[model samples]
Target: MPVGLMLVLAVTLVFLDLPLVVIVLFSFNSSSSLSEFEGFSTRWYRQAAENPDILAALGLSLTVAAAATVIAVVLGCLLSYAFVHGRRRVTRPVEAVAMSTLVTPELATAVGLMTLFTTAQLALSTLTLIIGHATFVLVYVTVLVGNRLRTLDPRLEEAAADLGAGRLRTFATVILPQLRSAIAGAAALSFVLSFGDFVTSVFLSGTEIAPLPVRIYGMLRFGLSPEINAIGTAMIVLTVLLGVTGLWLQRSRRSTTTSNPL
Candidate 1:
């Protein structure tokens, strides 16, 4: 890379990541001061761990993210398959709608969803939150897996069928294997998006259950606390881990495919 380009890239990264670095560092501060860090201590993490409301919100967030990821991955993969294999006349319009969700502002989607739920007499709850998240996340999974599917060799499926494999068998043995990395990436992305969602969760969350992001926002109403920083650091760590795992999976799949070439 050119020195100038490398400098620009380094500056951009620092600009983006400096705040997160500060948050992680301050989370361990012995005092609650945000401007200055005294010394490293796990006091905030301990407090956050002990807080009942934080714990409840964390658990609810995990449950909703997990459920939504599952729903999105399954439906998204099926939709991707249909887009690639189904008739163009029917799939084109559906694909357009799916893609539109990505460009649509999330706040608008949340409002539309809230209105729909109200019209249908559905109450805002964990179930509604999961549905809201899954509805948007499905588009991400579909795009990722569908792009992967489009790049695959169609003759593999034909050969499987020629060898007497049925549709399900061909998909399971041939297509699904090739799609494992894409699916894993999509699942991780979906989980992260759902877990970190604020706009949708804020609108759809019920009285009984609120996700961690919502809880964190509620905490802001009182005042800033070191414990919130600890929670934020934890979330950042999880998101980074998921992203790294997805990249590793994709690289491993590529290596395997290159070496085997079967």
Candidate 2:
């Protein structure tokens, strides 16, 4: 790489990751101060684990993320298959509309969801947060799985059809197996995105319940505590793991495609 490019990359990385690095370091701080780290300790992590409110918020976040991932994967895969294999003229416009969520500001989506819930007289809770999360993640699943589907040859399905297999059976036995990695990748992405999301969770959640991110934000208002750092560190580790897993699944899908070449 050019020297200028390398310098730019280094500066960008530092700018992005400095906060995370500080959070990880401060998670072990013996003092309550955000700056001037004292002796290292895992005390905050223990405190976080024992804290009921934090635990409740974490549970809510996980539940919302899991529920969203499941719903998004199912709907996204079906939509992706239809758009990829079925009529383009009809599905194309709809596909664009569905993915418009990606470009739409999260604040806009959050406000819209809040408005919709109010209009419907549905109370804001974990269920509403799950719905909000799913709306955004559905686009990720659809884009990833649809791209993977496009790479598949129609002859594979045709061959199965020629063998007198029912459409559903062929899909279940053949196409679904091929789609396993893509689905897994999509699920990982969906979970990470939903878990890390704050705006939608904040808007959709009732005052009675807060997701982890929102909880952490509330914690920051009073003062800096190592407990917040501990929670942030845990979340960073989790997000990294999920992101790495997604990348691995995508790579595995490519390998499978090259080796099988059907």
Candidate 3:
């Protein structure tokens, strides 16, 4: 039964990931249209490089993702700390409310955010999209940081305090270092979510603030452009590289801790 289930899972992965494989392969096709699988060529890649609009949209996406990740990390860490500490009574409800957004339909969140921003007279721009993305990413960050905090031994902080370290110093020197994996994981997830976001970006982006996802959607709507496949390939490569780096960092941390038991 277990082997059968594993086979099923493997089949599912292959089926789901087939589009990405096609995108990567089509990215190198000599043909301009993705429908025609011509001989291998890097023409689409070169075209993507020359397209200034694509470059601008990519830059905007990275900027919004970075900004949203920073905001999510800061707010998430604080909320995780508060909830992990004795202030659970106050923070638990807030945490629940924040998490509810994660399970809610994304379109619903986008509509609600748009309405709130409209009523508040907040202009729709990269900043507004960052706020919208942050709202969703915060839930992920909270889960990451909170799980790490739960695994941690509070006595370590107590020991630091006993050694005359102030609360801020203890947190900086002890807590943050231990939660490094969680922080990195959270930030990476938040950045990826914000970068590839479509629904929220569509609602929040102004005339001049179109991000990569929006650009890709427009290209897709026009038809399957090989340039879009090239972009998709690049995004897949980036995500894989970042995921591998995070895994290495996590393993390195675990190795160091195992080798040096204090």
Counting clashing residue pairs in each candidate, in order, gives: 0, 0, 0
Write the residue-wise lDDT of candidate 2 on 15-55 in tens digits.
99999999999999988878798798899999999999999
Candidate 3 per-residue C-alpha lDDT over 1-69 given as tens digits, one digit per residue, 9 for 90 to 100: 699999999999999999899989889989776577869899889999999999999999999999999
Candidate 1 vs. true structure, TM-score = 0.97
| Superposed model 3: Cα runs more than 4 Å off | 1-3
Clashing pairs in 1: none
- The per-model lDDT (C-alpha) reads 0.94, 0.91, 0.87
Q: How accurate is candidate 1 locally (lDDT)?
A: 0.94
Ranking by TM-score: 1, 2, 3
Worst 10 residues of 3 by lDDT: 253-262
lDDT of 1 at 133: 93
Candidate 3 C-alpha error for residue 257, in Å: 3.7
lDDT of candidate 1 over 53-125, digit per residue (tens): 9999999999999999999999999999999999999999999988999899999999999999999999999
Quick one: ranking by lDDT, best first?
Answer: 1, 2, 3
Model 1 misplaced regions, further than 4 Å = none
TM-score for all models, in order of appearance: 0.97, 0.96, 0.92
